[model samples]
Target: KGYGSGGKVTHANVFIGSLAEGTSEATLKDAFSPYGMIKSCYVRNKGDQTYGFCEFNTVSEAEAAIAGMAGKNDWVVKFANNDAWDDEVPHSNVYIGNMTEGTTEASLRATCGTYGTVESCTVKTDTETGKNYGFVKFSTQAAASRAIAALNGNDGWTVKAANNDTGGGGGKGWGGKGGWSDGWVWQPGPSTRNDDSRPEGPPSDNLYVKDLPPGITEDEVFAAFSKVGQVVDCYVLRWDNLSACAALVRMASTEQATRAKSQLSGTIHESCFGPISVKNQEKNGEKLEDHVYVKGIHCTTSEDQLRSIFGKYGTVMWCRILPLPFRAGAGSSSVPDVAALVQFASPEEATTAISAMDGKVATEFGAPMVVRFAEEKANAKRPAPTPNNNLYVKGWPVGFPEFLLQSEFQKCGNVVRLRLLDNPDPEYPTCAALVQMSRVEEATMAVTALHGRPLQVPLPPMRVKFAGKDQGADNSNLYVTSLPRTMTESQIRQSFSKFGEIERLKLLTQQGKPETHALVQLSSPQAAAAAIRELDGSTPAFKG
Candidate 1:
C-alpha cells in the first residue's frame, strides 16, 4: 500500500483506459514514458482482453503524465489521483463536440489555431465503422478559453471546454458538449466558399423597418428581389393588430445597392400598388436626414438589372420591391402597391443620389422615379402615476413574502407607503425595504424599537429615523444587543462611550438573571440608532 516517497505510484496506472482495441501495455508505457519515468506497467489480459494500469516512481511524475495525456483519443486515457493513497493529479484537457461530419484535424487546427498551439486533435470515431463522434486534446488554459468561446454554440456545431476523464471501450467520451448543460460560447465559424468574394461596391448598414401592408408577406417580397443577390433572412413583424413585412438582404456589396436602387426605383411589380423606394438605415443611433424614394417602377424589371442600375451609387445595403395582390381574371395581379425601404451608408451619399435623379425620368425603365427622405414616427404618451401614494417595494426574499416594515409598523400609524427594493443582480439578496408614515412621530418611533432585531434584514434594514435628528442628538442613548454571555455591563459601556456620550447601561434580565442583551443610554435616540445599526452584528469581543 505504501510506495516510498521517491517510489510514488505513476499516473500511467490511472491514465490508460479504453485504448485502441489492440494496443499493448508496453506500447502505452512507451507513449507516456517521455512525460515521466515509468517504473513498471502491467496490462491485464484474459483471452486477448486488454485492460490494465501502470505505476510511476513518484506522485508528481504520475500527475504530469495524467495532465499531458488527457483529451487524447488514440489512447483513451482517464487518470485520477489515488485517493486512498493521498496523491493528487491535476487535469489539463477537455472534450469538444457537435462537429460537422466533414470536420478534420486540418480544419479544427485552422479554426482553433488562432487561440494557441494545440497539443493534439483527436476525433473519436466508431471503432468498427470509423464515424466521428467527438474530439478531445490538451491545450493551455488561454487556448481552451478561446476555443470554447469561438466554437461553442455555433450555428452548426457545439464546443465545450472541460476536464478529461476516462472510461468504457468506445471512443465516446464525456465532458464538453454532451456532459455539460450550460450552452456553448459563441464564436463565428468560417463563411461558405461562395461568400469569399468582395461585394461589387461599398458595404451598407442593415436597417430594420416596420409598418408594412398587412397582406404583403415575406415570400412575395423575396421573389421580387431574388434576381439581385443572396437574401440572408426575411420575416414579417407581428403585433396585436398590425403586421409589418421585413427583410434582411446581403447583397454583393454597398455599391451594388446604389445601382440596384436606381434601376429598381419607380419600378412597379404587377402585384405592387405603388413605386418601391430604397434607403440605408443608420447604425449607433445615427439620424437619417436624407432619403431616396423611387416611384413608377415597371413590374417586370429583373433583380440583376435593378442591382446594375442602382449600384452606380456609392453603395447600397439592400433593396426590396413590394408586389401587388393577384387578380383572379387578369393574367397578372396588381393590388397593394406600398413603399419600399432602402438603407445607405451615409446621408450625404443618399442626398447626392436623390438630388441627381429625384423626379428624373428613367430612360431604361420609362417611369419617373421620386426620391425623398422618409418620415419619422411620433412618440407615444405615457400614463399618469396612480393618485394614491403607492410606494414601489423591491429587494425582499420572495419566500419571506410579508413586507417586514409595513406589517410590523402599520399598526402604529397610517401607512402611506411601503415597499422593498428589488435588485437586478442575483448575488445580493433582498435585504432592505422602505416605509413611509402619515405622521413624522410614528416614523421616529418605528426607527427606535426594531432597528437591529435578528429577524430584520441586515443590509441597512428599513428604519424610520428623522432626517435631521442626527445633527441635534447628544451621544448618550444607544442600545446594543446579542452581546456574548460572558461580557459585563461596565465593559460594554466603556467600549461604546468612545463613539459619543453614553449616559447609562440597562442589561435585559430574565427572572432577575443577567441576559446577553444590553441597552446603552446615548445622548440622543438618533445616536443610539446609529450605534446599534453599525455595531449590531460584528463579531469582535466587547472591550471596556
Candidate 2:
C-alpha cells in the first residue's frame, strides 16, 4: 500500500530474482509483456552482472505477471524489496560519459529525458583538472532501461544503468565517487514554490531570455542583468525572419540564474522596450559566444581610430587588425578590410557593439563595420579527417549507408569505428566519412587499395586519404601568431579557458617573425581538438 510520497500512486514495481547469468532485460520484458501494461523493466546488476526487476502500471498487472511466470522460467522474481517503489526507484541513476568538450548539463537532461522522467542529473567534474563525467537518474526502471538501450556507447559516450557498487552509486549514492564534491551540480528545489517567485525548471546555472528589442544593445542588456549577478557569456540572436531578437546568458551559479529568471521574466527593464521572457537555457539549438566577429572596414582603417569611434559604449578590451595575405614574403595583398575587431570587456558589450556598429559605417573608414557574432563550434567549419587508425573517405555512393561501409571495410581488416558526416562547408561541402581500422597496418592497406576505388556506378571516385593532422605534431600544444600586442599571458589564458584547463600559455618572440607567437598547452587532447577545430584560420580578439 506504500506507493507514493503521499497520495499519488500509479504503478507497482516487480522484482525478478535468481536470474541466469546471461539473462537480459528484453527477455524479462517479453516474459511479462503479455500479462498487462508494462511501465518499466530492467535486469538488476550486482557488479557488472544483471539480476532481474520490472515494473507494471498497477498492482493487477504485476499480479498477472507473477502468476503467469511462476513455475515456468528458471528464476525467482517478485516485487523488488517486497514491492518497494520508493526504495528502489531513487537508485535508477545512470552514468553517461564520452561527452564532447563543452557539453552542458542542460543539453544532457534535454537529450536523456527523451526516454523518461529524469528525476535528477549530476554532472561530475574534476575541479582541479576541468574534466567532466555525468550521472543521470530516471524515476522508473523503464526510463533507465530505455535510455541505456538507446544512448549507451552512442555519440562517443558510454551509457549504462548504474549499479549498487561504490562507483555505480547505489540508492544512497549521489554522483560517482570523489566527483561532484563541491562541484557544479543541479537538483529540483522545493515543491512549494510560489508562482510569483522563482519559477521551476530543471535546475541549471544558465539562463536564456527572449524577445529583446532591437534598440536595446548587448552592452545595455549586460549592464541591466549585471545588477543581478556577473554574466559569464551573453549571445543575442536575430533571425531575419523574426522582428525581435533573443539572448542566452550564463550566470555564475544556478541559484543566481534561478533568482534572476524569476525576478526578471515578464518585467521590462529600464532600457528595454518589451517584457523579456527569462527561463533556464535549453540545450536544444543553443549557442555559446566567445567574441564578436567583425568585417567590412576600409583597408586604411587603423585600430586606434576604430577604437576611438567605438570606445564610447564600454571598456574597449583590445583592438586587432586582420592581417592581409602576404605575397613573396614582402608586400601584403590589397584587401578591402583590415577588419578591426573592437573587443569589449564582456560579451554583453560585444553584443551591443555589434548591434550598433554592424550596419553603421566606421567614422574613419567611410564604410560600415559589418559586425557579427562568430559561428559556434557546431556550426563552425568541420576539421579535415584525423589520422588515427581512422581514415577519412569522401565521394562514396549517395545511398550507401554506414552498415554497408562497415561490411566492405571489414574485407581489408577489422572495422573498429566508421562514421559519415554531412557536408557543412559552403565551398567544398560533400558527403564525408571517417573509418578507424583495427590496426595501423590495416588502415594503411585500406588507404592504399581503396584510394580512388569505385563504390557505386556513375558516382565520383571514392577519395580515401589520411585526414590532415593539426599543424602541431599533437594539438596539446598550439602555436599561434597575429595576436594583438596588448594581450598579456593572463588575457591569452582567459581567452582559451573555455576549451579546457590550460596547463601553460605564453608568448614567444622571434627576431625574424613579423608578429609575436603564442603557445598554449591544454590538459587533454580533446580540449586541444576543440580549440583547433573551432579557431583554426579564424581570428579572435582578446581583452587585456
Candidate 3:
C-alpha cells in the first residue's frame, strides 16, 4: 500500500510493472504528467512484456502517481525497489564485452532471456576503435549471475557483474578496464587498482569520485568540494555504458584532498542518488585561499574593470567572469550581469576587498554587489541602512524607463535626481537606481509608500531604502580634488548638491601647480563628510 520493504518513500523513482506491449515511455509520461513534474520516464522491454520507471521531481508526486494509477489499466505501480536506489553497484546489470560485429541489442536480449528476464539490453560501439560492446540488465541479481556463468565463454564474450570485475569463473571481468591506465582510470565502475596505494608514499591532491547521480553537473561537484577545501578544477566523466556519472575533483593541496575524501566519501549528497566513493589519485591539485567570488557584476563590466575597482584594496592576481548557463527567456537574451571570481595576492587583500565591496553598489552598476570567499555560499541580503535624503531603489523590471521610477517617487515628494543602473543579482532580474528627494521627509515617505509595492502591476516589488550613508552628517567643509580644468563654480555646486545643500563652492588655482582643487561647504556636515568619502581621490566628472 505505502512503500515496500523500506517503510516510506524518500526518492522520486516510481516503478511501473506489467505494462502492455504497446505501452511506451510517452504513455507513462502522460499517465504521470497530471500528478506532478516528471524528471525522466524510461520503458524497459523484456521480450513481449514491458516495464518502466517514472522519476518525478518530488516524492509526493511519485506517491500521487502511484495512488492514482495503481489499480487502473492492470498496471502494478509502487515505489521503485529501494535497494536499486541505495546501491551504487547494482548487481542486476551485467557487462558483456568482446562481442563480434553481428551482435545487436535484440540478439543480446534474446540470449540473456534464457537465464532470466532481460529488463533492458544496450549495445554500443567504441568511437575510436569501432568495437561493439553491450550490457544486459536483468530483473534480479540471480538472473544476471546465471547469464554471466552460461554466456561468459560459450559465446566467446567476456561477461561479468557490472560492479564486479571477477566473473564467477575468476577470470578478468568488468574490473580489468578499471585498472590504472597511465594516470587516469575509467569511472562508473569501481577502480580495481590504485597507484598511490603505498602507505609510505606522499598523499595526492586529486580525488576520484565515482557513482555520482545521473544529471549531476560539474559545477555542483565543484561546489561540494569547494566547501571542503579550495577547488582548482572539477571534471565530470560520462560513459555510454554507465547510467551514473563520475568526477575528478582536484583540491588545492594533498591535505585538502585528504579532508575532502574523509568528509565526502560514502556520504549521501543532495541528489539522493547514493553514497559516492572518493579516493585519492596520483595527480597534483592547486593551492588555496585569496580567491573571492563577486556576484551582481554588470554584464557590460569586464575583468579589467573588476581589477580596477578592487585594486584599491590590494594587488589582484586575476579576474574572470562566469557565463550564465541559460537565458531568462527566449526573447530576453541579454543578461544584466555575469558573476566573477577575483584572485588577490593574499587572503588579507581578499578579505579587505570583500568587506569594502560586499554591499556597496558599484558606480557603474547601481546594484549592490555580494562578495565572499570562493568556497563559501552567498549570505542573505543585508538589511536597509539608516534613512536619509538620498534613496536607493532597486527591483524595478529590467528596461523600465527611468522617467517612470522618478515619476513614481515624485508622488511622495520632489524628485531631485534619479540615476538608473543595471542590477547584477541573479535573484532579482531588474534595474536599480539612486534617487535623491528634495528633503529627507520626502525620501522617508517614498520608502514607506513604495518599499514593498510595485510601480506596475504583476512586476516584482521595488525595494526602497536610504543610501548606506548620510554623507553630510559629520562635516561641512570638504577639500575635493581631481576637478577638471573647465569646471566652473556653478558646475561644482550642481555636482555636489546631491550630497546636500551647498553652502559654498570654489575652485582654487595655485601658482605653478598643475592639479586643481575645490573647497566645498554643504549645509549638512554629514552630507559633506559623505561627499568627501565618496569623492576623495576620484576625478569629478560634472555632467552640467
Candidate 4:
C-alpha cells in the first residue's frame, strides 16, 4: 500500500513486486508464512499495477522470505521502502551497467517499473566499444532505491545512484531506514570502505616510498618518481604529531615500478626527503596480508576498543587481545604491556592501519601503540580462561543504545555490571560491550545462546565469549602507565581516589623517560574496576 509523505516503515516489512494476476492477501501470506510468523500480508493496487507486502515477526524472517522467494517463480522480493508511498521526497536517477546483449529500453523499463513509477528509461551503446549501459529515473527516491536494491548484483547487472546529490542508494536526504539504506549496501569513495573485502580488480603497479620528511606534497612525490617512469598517481599520507610521513606512487606499469624501485631504493630526493626507501608496494607484503600486530596496549583496553580504533582504516574482521600472563611466547611473559592481533578485511586496509597507528602516542590509547604486520599466527593465542563469568560481546554497530545492553543481558542471569566499550574513532560503526554476570553458568548460557544470535533487526549477530583472565572478578590491581613523571604519587591517588580507598599506589619511572608507570591496588576489586571504567582513557582534571 502507498504511504503518505512522512510515513514510516517498519524493518520487518518485505516488498513484493510483480504480484501474480488474481493473487489475494491470502496468497501472499501463504507464500511467506512458511519462512516465518507473518504479522500481516496484503495486496494493494496502485493505478493499473498490483503489488504486495508481507510483514513478518522479525527482520530476519523478512530476509528469509526474500532469500527463499527470490529467483524462484519470477518473484521479485526486497525490503519495503518506508518512503515508497511518499510522493513529496526527492526522486532518483540510476546508472545501470553490464546489461546483457540486445536488451531494449522497453525491457529495462518493465523491470524497474515493477518497483516504482518509471518516469523515464534509456538504453545506450558505446559506439567505440559496443558496451551497452542504461539509466532508469524513478518518480521518487524511494522507488529508485527499491529498484536498485532488487536488481544490483543480480544477473550481472550493476545498479547504483548516478550521483551523491540524489537521495537514493544510501545517500543523504533519505529520511530513515528503507529501501537500500537499511543494511550494508554499496556506495562510493572512502565513505563506503567498510566492505573492502570485495575484489577490487587486480593489484596496481604501485610503489611505497617511506622516510619522507614532513610537509611533502603529492606533486613533489610525483616529480621525484616520474623521472623514472610514467606516474599514474601519488598520495602523501600523514597524521597528527607525526615526525616523518609516507607516500604511495602508482606507476603506469609493473616493469616501470620494478625499474624505479631497483634504482631509487635507499636514494634521497634532495628536495623533499632524507634517505628514502623505495620498494614495490605489493612487495611490502603487509599490504597483501590482513592481520596487524598491536602492542603497548593498556591492560584495561578492550578488544572492541581495538576494533573501533583499527576500523578507521577499514572493516575489522575480528580483534583478539592477549592479556598479560598471555604472551606471544612463554618466555615473553615479562612483557608488561597488553597485546592484540586485529584482522581487517583487506591487506591494503591492514597496511593503512599500520601506517596510521604504528608508534601512535594518543592519550585515548593510554600509551604509544606499536602497530605492524602480523605474520601468520605471529603470536600463539591461548584459549580464554574458562569458568569465567565476564563476557565480551561484539558485532553491534556503533551508536547503538548502550542502555539497552543491561536489560538485554538480564534475560540470561543477574548482571553484576554492564559497560559499553568506547570507540575513539567516531567514524567507525562497530562497537562492543562487556558484561559481568553473577555466575559462570549464566555467562556460558549467554555465550551459547547469544553468539551468532540476532539481537537487533538489520544489525549483525552478536558475538559473545569469555573475556581474558586479567578481566576476571578476582582482579583488583591496575597496571597503569603513561603518567607524567612529575605527576607524583598523591596526584595519581587523587585522580582515582574518588572511586574507592587506595590500598597501595606505587609509581615507577625509568632513568631516561619522561613518563612514569603506576601499580594501583584499591580496597576492593569493584573499586578497581570502577576506577578503570572512569579513568581508562580519560585525562582527569588534576589541580597543581
lDDT by residue for model 1 over 1-544, one digit each (tens)?
A: 2121112222123546666567775687777787765544445444655554555544446667777877676555554343211111122234666566777887776666544445456666567765564554433333344456556777566666444322100112210111101111111112222322432222342222222222233444444444554433344332111112223433334454444445544444323232233433344666464435554444323334445566576476665544422111100011122223344566776776666554344444321222111222246333433333233333234324455556777756678777665544322223346677787677666654443222343222222222221323443344344443334444564556555754444443211122244545555666666766666565423321
> Per-residue lDDT for 397-422 in model 3, tens only?
54445887887899999998899875
Ranking by TM-score: 3, 2, 4, 1
Q: Local error of candidate 1 at 117, Å? A: 26
TM-score for each model? 0.18, 0.24, 0.26, 0.20
Candidate numbers sorted by lDDT from highest down: 3, 4, 2, 1
lDDT by residue (1-544, candidate 4, tens digit) is 2111111122457888887777787788778889987644556677777888776654557768888998666778987764343232233678889899989999999888766556568899989889899988664455666677678998899898775323223322111111122121212212222423433323336666554432334445666677788775566654211123456776778778777776765454433211111111243554437777765554324455567777888998888766333111111101133456787898788888878766444334321111111122335553535678998876444445666666677888999988888756332334568899999999988876675444642222222111122566665666665554334444565677687655444444332333445666666677767777677766633321
Query: Candidate 2 on 1-544: residue-level lDDT in tens?
Result: 3221111122356778777788876788778899876655555557765566676654556767877886576666555553433432223558887677677788889887665556567777767766677887665545665677678778778887564322211112211111111111111111211311433345555565653432223444565567777665565553211123356666667677777776666444443211111121223466323245555544334456557766765687777666543100000011122344556677676666666665443434421111112223334543545555878776543334578777767888999888987645221212569998989889878876765444432211211111123443344656556543323454555557787666544444322222344667666666776776666555554321
Best by TM-score: 3
List where candidate 4 sits over 4 angstroms from the true fold: 1-26, 29-81, 84-91, 164-544
lDDT of residue 500 for candidate 2: 69
RMSD of 1: 28.5
Kindly provide the TM-score of model 3 when superposed on the true structure, using C-alpha atoms. Answer: 0.26
| lDDT of candidates 1 onward, in order | 0.42, 0.51, 0.56, 0.56
TM-score of 2: 0.24
lDDT of 2: 0.51
In candidate 2, stretches whose alpha carbon ends up further than 4 angstroms from where it belongs are 1-11, 45-50, 82-137, 140-544
lDDT, candidate 2, residue 409? 79
In angstroms, the error of model 4 at 226 is 68
Please say which candidate is ahead in TM-score: 2 or 3. Answer: 3
Give me the overall lDDT of model 4: 0.56
